[model samples]
Target chain A: MSSREIDRIDGSALPLRGDNIDTDRIIPARFLKAITFEGLGDHVFEDDRAAMADHPFSNPAYRQARIILTNANFVSGSSREHAPQALNRWGIHACVGESFSEIFRGNSLAIGLPCVTMSAADMGPLMDLVERAPDTSLTLSLSDRTVTVDGQRISIAVDAAVRDAFLAGTWDATGLLLDDFEVVRGVASRVPYIRGF
Target chain B: MGKTLLKKVWDLHTVRPLSTGQTQLFIGLHLIHEVTTPQAFDMLRARGIGVAFPERTFGTTDHIIPTLDQTRPFQDTLAEAMLSALERNCAEYNIPLWNLDSENQGIVHVIGPELGLTQPGMTIACGDSHTSTHGALGAVAFGIGTSQVRDVLASQSLAFEPLKVRRIAVNGTLGNGVFAKDVILEIIHRLGVQGGVGHAYEYGGTAVDAMSIEERLTMCNMSIAGGARVGYVNPDQTTFDYLRGRRFAPQGDAFDRAVSWWRSIASDADADYDDVVEIAAAEIEPRVTWGINPGQSVGVSERIPATGDAGTNGAVAEALDFMGLVGGAPIMGTRIDVAFVGSCTNSRLSDLREAARIAKGRRVASHVKALVVPGSRAVLAAAEREGLDQVFREAGFEWRGAGCSRCLAMNPDRLEGNQLCASSSNRNFKGRQGSPTGRTLLMSPAMVAAAALAGEVVDVRDAL
Candidate 1:
């Protein structure tokens, strides 16, 4: 089994100021019609970018941002992995938010994108740092459990299991799951419903 | 303390503990659809991996199928390409698929239960977030991303972290015209959208227990909207009766045995829950979302909350700006141009019947464009058998074929620019209904029907 360890991401951050930023707003359903996820990044937040004159994705200063900073319940609607796939393809390596929906976090982790949590109070300065200095570099270190920007450290929280998965390069769960084919069959056999009782 | 149903089911599905502090949980059933599976199949092929248990997986075309014309070669070539890819992948992997022409075809969640494939105590995974709909049948169901879909296809299992169980007990009886949709909306409104994170909502108590199987499905269907990836009610006689003779359900003596096992999986009366929330069912009213998320809802008679509402945290302001609604105004009479009553959330026969009842003797307002789409072909056939379709057509509401028509708007049924629609489907997110500028007001199917006739938001109870 081969997987890439994603313990740290260092780059400029894009700040999307909103709570409950849903997947529909991230990558609209119309864009999901394609058979492949290719070119989805071009359409990420397509509507939002068009509608909001100051939307971060449309801002030229944040064009090459590799990290995203956002508010609570980020990516709340739809479990389409395409939302994260679009962000990943858009060069987002990590997201720091007040909170994230369960499915969105899982989807991001599966693709080796670390979604970390920070307090709203902590996020305020980080978001300001990114917005005030668009070119400022932010470093998210899973090993240290902190995001460092302009020599200031902000404590962040990642689910322990998720942190371990990223650190161990087991974030690609298919190989980990496929390694236990025999045990899976054994469990399936024991379930009465699977065996027609 | 006794174990909750989630605990029992999670233990039953556990294969082994992984070093990443997760359990390799076996999936009893895996559902796929065209939108999310193509990439997963690609991943499997790239890895030289074959489907581990093809029989346990099921595929369908819903998101991209054009509802109006069920013809070969869809008008949208991109949609056609997606459907073709799903067909080719399913055939290559030996996975059973319910294609557009198949009687079994519909939304993946709808068909899974209608065919009796979703059962009690099973762990169900699907690419669509509405997979929680199967939890109505007492299954431990949750939506997954494509990578996890690939994981299940490769090993019939996933590395899962167990969820804490929260028992949301809705006691008392529902008031007149207060449907399951209202009950869940009230729950989401009471609890913030992110309240159920890291937990599985165990819906129960008098109100939830008294709900029919279809009603329970509607309630569970929006669990994801409330931030719970998994939600379920313990299987009861109601569940067994609903599944009794359906296609994939156990038969004869086996069914009797299965019921016993199903009953055993119910959360114990003295079950230990991470938390408990009690709601008075009578307090729920027909709900209407006035904002961009499901949780931004108000009772039919209530006014929209102003930005000054203490807990809104500027969301109220953002929603008002986006929806073009004034704060403190009554949500009762907001004008609407469209009405859609179909989705995995509320496109069943019962939902159709409810909407048809409101449309039976009334004409849709001249300015309103309305349509009814069934959850499944089976639902459509049953509605036709009951002449519910005729009632809708006579009322000037178009009766269309099954597929997830307007909800998410992957198909041709979509909102035009800047039109406000009263929708029965879940999620009122910006751009959710095809048009970026179009606005959606989430409500029950009956409410959507009432809105259609009134050309504005109105209480369904008035018609009832």
Candidate 2:
């Protein structure tokens, strides 16, 4: 494992207080027909934002923000990989929520993005800060497994394996499978081979 | 101490439990589709591996196949490549493939049971998650990843941990207009999306046992979103009868032996369970999704729940904001602009008949665009036989060919930006119908017909 702490993404956090913002809402299912994940950032919430012009993320000031903090159930719906790929194309580096759908977590992890789950209380102040000050640089540290919005430390529990995978930048699912195979083989080697001559 | 469907299937398939905390389980049938197989085949080619048991596996195209027009050299280059790749892989492996022109062509989940390929006592695997839909026939069907797909193709076995099984028993009788779609929507709503997270649900009791094979398939299909590995109903006369004459199923004496084994694999009447859930059949109504997820649901008679009324479940608040729905408005009067009736969830001939029965002699509301998609060619032929297509066409519903149209919007069937849809398909996650801002309200096939006629959310009972 790598010893260095992976650098956290810096951004003016875009806080969406919505519930059940699903994979399609994150990126519409129409975009999934495309061959690759390139250029999907252009269509992010294309219809939702088209109706609601004043939404925070639609504003030009939030263009460079790489971190997004939303309420729980941020990613729910069909297990479409295009959802997170759209977010990544939109330049999203990390997402923090109270909870996530199991399929969403698996897809996000496969592509090297971290979905951080924080306490609802921890998210409230940060949401307020983002809405109150658009220019505020909120630092989200996945390595520390905490959310610091406008310099306020918010404790959020994270799975050690998820943290280590992101921190070491060793988020290779295929590599993980290889390691698993070796370990399984090692255990088998120590056991009796009933039929193999 | 529990004997769930998972245990029953597991014991029947196990050769031995390996030292690596996984069981060496035999797979009796393997189903594949175009979308997830191209990459898996490439991986196999790189390693010089071939499918171990060619006769036990089958392939078809669904995900990227067009329902509207499937001309040569598709407008979608990637889709064309995917189809080409899958065709090549199937040919290279000498596996029987039912391509687009075949009379049997349709969604993998739909075709498996139609041809009697899915049967009781069979351990089935597909690369797509909705593979569980075939479990309606009492088979143990689960989705696996691409690597696992390669694993199955190479070895005809999968190594995996055992899953707990939950027995969802529904008793009593269902009210008219409350179809199978309502039964599944109610199950997901009452259980919440995560309720079945680590379990395979074995649906039984008077309700499941009483249902037609098609209705049972709809119930098993949605178990994926409920977080279950798979779901099934036990095999019986209905199952054996369905498989008895299919092209792929065993014939005559062999079939007799197969039926005997299939019957024995069913959970014993005295079988214990990890958990038992009781749902009254009369308690369910024509349901719909009020917010972004299937969990964010309400009956057609109820209104959307407010985030403030969510009472500290953080997910509810998030769902509400994403949905932009006001909690207090009655769902009954909510206007709908589109109505889609297709997908592996509710696209069978029986589903169309239920919808058409309600839609008979009634036109869709002027502003509402209604569509009726058959699950497969066989369903289309069967519907045509019963004049169900005429009923749909007279009702102002677009009668389309077979495919997984608008379920995930990989094809042309999609909701224009923010168009709310009364859908009979399985899911209702935000933007699931092709429009990122589109809202989906899931319900029974009958309810979708009623909603389409009224051009808004309406009680199916009123239409009935």
Deviation of model 2 at A54, angstroms: 9.4
TM-score of each: 0.99, 0.81
Docking class of 2: incorrect
- Worst lDDT run of 10 residues, candidate 2 chain B, spans B15-24
Q: List the residue pairs that clash in candidate 2.
A: A18-B318, A18-B321, A19-B318, A19-B319, A20-B318, A20-B319
Question: Candidate 2 on B112-210: residue-level lDDT in tens?
Answer: 999988877678988777777888888888776555676677766666556777999999888887777778778887887767755788898898888
Which consecutive 10 residues in model 2 chain A have the weakest lDDT in total? A188-197
Worst 10 residues of 1 chain A by lDDT: A188-197
